[model samples]
Target: MKRARGRGPLSTVVGIVLLALMLFPVYWMVNASLQPAGSTLRGGWFPLHPDFGGYAVALREQGRNLLTSLLVSLGSVVLGLGLAAPAAHALARFPLRGTRAVLLAVLVTQMVPGIVVADALYDAYAGLGLLDSYLGLVLADSTAGVPFAIIILHAFMRTIPGEIIEAARMDGAGRLRVFRSVVLPLSTNALVTAAVFTFLFSWSDFLFALTLTSTPSVRPITLGIYEYLGAHTDQWNAVMATSVLASLPAALLLVLSQRFVTAGATSGALR
Candidate 1:
């Protein structure tokens, strides 16, 4: 027990060193954004006289695109959960034939390259008139979100005991009611987990956003940053400022959603 009490000091120091190495780039990105002007990272390690000019330009130019990304990500989350929850519940509870095959297919879809999916979607979307529209992006993003959510939701829901589900049924609750009142309420963590991951996937998506949208009218923030690479390379501060703005939402979501994945604990002990 004493041996398992904590890691040794050397191990802790090693871990901290690795963590700092990983975070150095993020620190540099923030540091670069504050500089008034820099063709390269000659702004030193600290910004004594921080300039807000880059942030000003980012907000004025990319604010609308940022809002567009937020809208599409949220839409993908709702649409993904709406489909995945019921399907995952059914897959978890029912002993339907070919369940393993279906799960395998879902996993296989993840292995398929995003570029291929984007190309196929482009052709279908062009005929269906979904190009360069909010609905189009939402639907495209959900192709990733829905499958991933199903995998996450299914893994969690499977842990729910059959006895609890039976108790709900014995009390005269319909299948839908039991799902709504009991299973869903107890699986709150899984639902939130799935939603958060789905949101992040849709948020950071560049391929589908790049392929599906042509006009600037429905551009996401990722595309906005791509524009900075060409048009504003000389303005590196603005470019970094745009990157910082883009990373803020995903970072905040990850920080705010505290994941407590209890291993094989009973539902009563969850809270």
Candidate 2:
């Protein structure tokens, strides 16, 4: 047993090193955001004199875009979850004909390039007069969310014992009633996992935001960050600040949904 466990300390050190390497960029961004505007050239390595001006400028300029991102991400989450949950339940429990084929198709979608989807959406949106609209962006962003949510939820839902569902049905509960009342509540961890990822996917989406919205009227923070990078090349501080702000929702969600995420991963692996 001692020989078997001899690698544990080394493995832990390696894991900590890998984690720090992954998070180093975030630390750098926060550090740079605190530096005085144009001081990015000096490479201070630390914020000896932290400045709030960058954040102030970011808020003033990208505030509307931040709100737009929040709305679009939330809309994508609601729409994506609404569509994915029932489909996942059906796919998990029904054993319908061609179920494997359908699941294969959903898996195949994950392999398709986002650019192809964006191109198709742009053409369709132009014809439907959805170009540069909030609805258009939301629908486009859901492309990322729906398939992922379905897979995650389906994996988790499949592990839910069939006996419970049958018990609910034996009590005269309809399929819809059992799904709504019993399946949904029990699938809370999976749902939260799906919601968190869907939110993050939509929130960090730059391609759809770039393609679906032709005007600033519906621009998201991702696009705003892009434009900021281009227009404010000299103002790295503000750009970093905006990036930091854009990351807040994702960070907050990961922190708050830690338990659910852990449960989902374990359940998915077991299923």
Candidate 3:
């Protein structure tokens, strides 16, 4: 019908508008980063002649921390998912007494403010001589990231029926074997989703990294960006440029693994 056709076009226009609104800040950041300081802001909608100098400054001046941030994010994703997957598998298949309560406890732990635990964590890290270290940040980020990974992967694991697992067991596979063979393949989508989520959390975390790591040697890019801003307050161009650069890895990660996200969201909708 004409009405249906018109509705489809209108819906598409609305969706495109919404997407533009959401991406406007990113577009502006990229645009601003391409322009010389104050050039884009000097009464223009976009750069007259876009340049890559901001990106150059961001790389040469701040690339080291970007690498460190990538390491931190990737490390947290691998470690968090490693620890969470088995626990999620167990929680999904053999959920025990008080499991819901424990899940509630895990979710509740996430709600606690970072400031509330900062002092205690600082003291603990200092006692362990982990102050201003990557290990310390990794541990902190893992603690923060685990609960979400567990909840998310557990939900995805539940989407897989128990019969497949039981069949693996019947074929003389042990629990661990069954998990490796039957569950892991189907749950790759969840793993990617959890990794992406965990990476984002660890990548963007400022409070923990800033409080834990005192030096640029181990601090992630988020903290580096803050330091960049503090030291270059008058250099808004460099600051924005650094911010735009900082977001690239996560953006690339999402783009690269978007297929997993689609599969996980559609077929693995957590029960």
Candidate 4:
């Protein structure tokens, strides 16, 4: 048998260097968070004497914002999936008219600049008394999640064998039953993919949060961090500490669900 080949030394070195460059900022953020001064400008390369005071201050100051973010993100996931999954299923399985146009419109919406959506939603939301509210934020964030989830779920649903669906229908299952029992179970990977990304999108949303809210009520962590950047310019460690905390959920989720994400994303591709 032939021996297993390894990457060339030069390529390995290049990859290592590139990785270091990409990850340097993250390491620096953690480093700054550990510094007693929380000052990046004067921070040492290593935390010879680490300080977690920054985290204490972050928890004390921004805890409510973090919780608000979680609630809004979760709400977005629920609303987004509720809307996306069915639309995707109909588009993929049904021979509805203008299906292609609707899909195209979805793609176009993604291309529309976020600032434009925020601007338009501001007046409409204000008129509806949704300003500075969790519902408003969830609705706005769902714009991003719903479209993305539709595209992902559509692609994955298209890969479901036609015979399986027909068999389910023949067994006295109506359309809704077929969808709930047949389609959803087979689409687990895609559902997880959509849910994970939806959560991430809503979790990281800033444009809607910034535009729609003028009050201290329902502040997500992104807005909290932005205001903190200005309000606590001297306390870089606390800011960085909050950054680390915010990064944790998304990072952990992505790492844990990487396999499902990759599988779902690539499921419909033909060989």
Candidate 5:
């Protein structure tokens, strides 16, 4: 028992070290954001005298872009989940033919370069009058989310016991009823995991934001950050501050959905 107890401290130390290494970049960003606006090279390892000017400027300039990103990300999540949930359920529970081929096709999409999709969509959007539109950006961003959500949800859903679904059906529940009441409720962890990742994917999307929208009226935060980088080359603090602000959703999702994320990973792996 003493020998086993002794190993615990070593494992704890290693874990702490690994966690710090992972978070160092975030710490650096926050530290830089607090430094005075100037050449980032002149910033110190830590900010002894924190400055708020960077945040003020970031809020003033990037606020609308941040809101645009929020709306687009939310829209993408809604559309992605609406399409993916039913598809995943069908793929997992229904005795549909060509399931393997369908899954393969979905996986193939992840391999296609984002630039290729963007180029194709740009031409399509131009013809459809969707260029520089909110709906266009949302749909473009959702291309990343939908396939991934389907895979994750399908993996998790397949692990649900067949007997449980059978019992639900035997209780006078129809297909949609069983799915809504039983399958979805049991798949909460996977749903949260999918939603969190989809939100992150849409939120961090830069290529689609750059290619799909030509007007400032619908620009996302990622594009805003790019423009900021070019126009305020000397204001590294504000740039870093904007980056930090943009990263809030991902951080918050990870923290809030930590338990569900762990469960989803384990469940999906077993499937």
Candidate 6:
């Protein structure tokens, strides 16, 4: 009993310390954003006084519309999830001769860096007149997310007993019907987890959004924040302010899906 009590306090202290370390940067970002411009230069990390003017500036700035970023992020999340779900379902349920090869290809894609293909993708988009468009960004972001989605959902589907699928087929249900009625319902955890990851990746993509897009009307928040920086100077307060604002949707998304994420992670590869 004495040893258990001692370990409890030690574990609690370690947990609190880790939490503080993880949250300090977020606290500082919010603190700096609330400070008056140029205050960070003199005051360093902590703000002398907190204000909302920085947020107002970030919101209403002519060439850095944060609203556009929010809309694009939301749209990307929806589109990517929509595309990923069907592909994941097909890959999980169907067994072609090259199915393993195709799955391996998807896994291999995660290894390729997005930056490496940016220039080539930019040139292709430019040729197709897709530069400075939300569709272009969404398509690029979707490709990045699809591979991981397939891998995740595939494992979850594999965990499901083959007997269930065989039973469904014996009942005269077609493959699509079986997927809709059985597999999809069972894999909601994986689907929700994939959506969370897709949203984060799409919202946080900076390189493709920066190089492929130039106009503020279509710029995502990641690139919108860059407008505050210059060739030789930077605005730390607005950058921090915009950064905080930009992070809200992603936070809200994860919070809403926390249950599914928890279930998905704890369940492991489906089974």
Note the clash tally of each candidate: 0, 0, 0, 0, 0, 0
Which sequence of candidate numbers ranks them by lDDT, best first?
Answer: 5, 4, 2, 1, 3, 6
Query: What is the per-residue lDDT of model 3 for residues 1-271, given as tens digits with 9 covering 90 to 100?
Result: 9999989989999999999999998888777777776544652468678767777778887889988888878889889989999999888889599888878997998999987777779989989999887778888888778998898888888889888888888889999898888898989988888888899989988888867888767878888887887776655566778888788888899999999977765665635
Q: Write the per-residue lDDT of candidate 2 for residues 31-140, one digit (tens) a residue.
A: 99999888577758899889989999999999999999999999999999999999999999996999889989998999999999999999999999999988998899
- For model 6, how does the per-residue alpha-carbon lDDT over 1-271 read when each residue is reduced to its tens digit? 9999999999999999999999998998898888877746564565666778777766666225566665666677678767777777776666757878888998888888888778888999999999998888887787777777778777777777889999999999998898889988988998888878887888888888887898766887777666666521345666677788888888988899999988876665435
Better of 4 and 5 by TM-score: 4
Error of 3 at 239 (Å): 2.2
Q: State which candidate has the highest lDDT.
A: 5
Off by more than 4 A, model 6: 1-7, 41-49, 62-64, 166-172, 231-235, 268-270
Per-model CA lDDT versus the true structure: 0.87, 0.92, 0.83, 0.93, 0.93, 0.78
Off by over 4 Å in 5: 1-22
Per-model RMSD to reference: 3.1, 1.7, 2.3, 2.2, 2.4, 2.8
Tens digits of per-residue lDDT for model 4, 111-190: 99999999999989979999989999999999999999999999999989999999998999999999999999999989
**Collision count of model 2:** 0
lDDT for 271 in candidate 2 is: 65
- Candidate 1: regions farther than 4 A off: 1-7, 260-271
- lDDT of the structure predicted as candidate 1: 0.87
- The positional error of residue 232 in candidate 2, measured at the CA in angstroms, is 1.0
Candidate 1 lDDT over residue span 41-145, tens digit each: 578789888988999999998999999999999999999999999999999899899998999998899888999999999999999999999999999999998
Better of 2 and 5 by TM-score: 2
Error of 5 at 13 (Å): 6.6
User: How well does each candidate superpose onto the true structure, as a TM-score?
Assistant: 0.92, 0.94, 0.90, 0.95, 0.92, 0.86
- For candidate 3, the per-residue lDDT at 64 reads 92
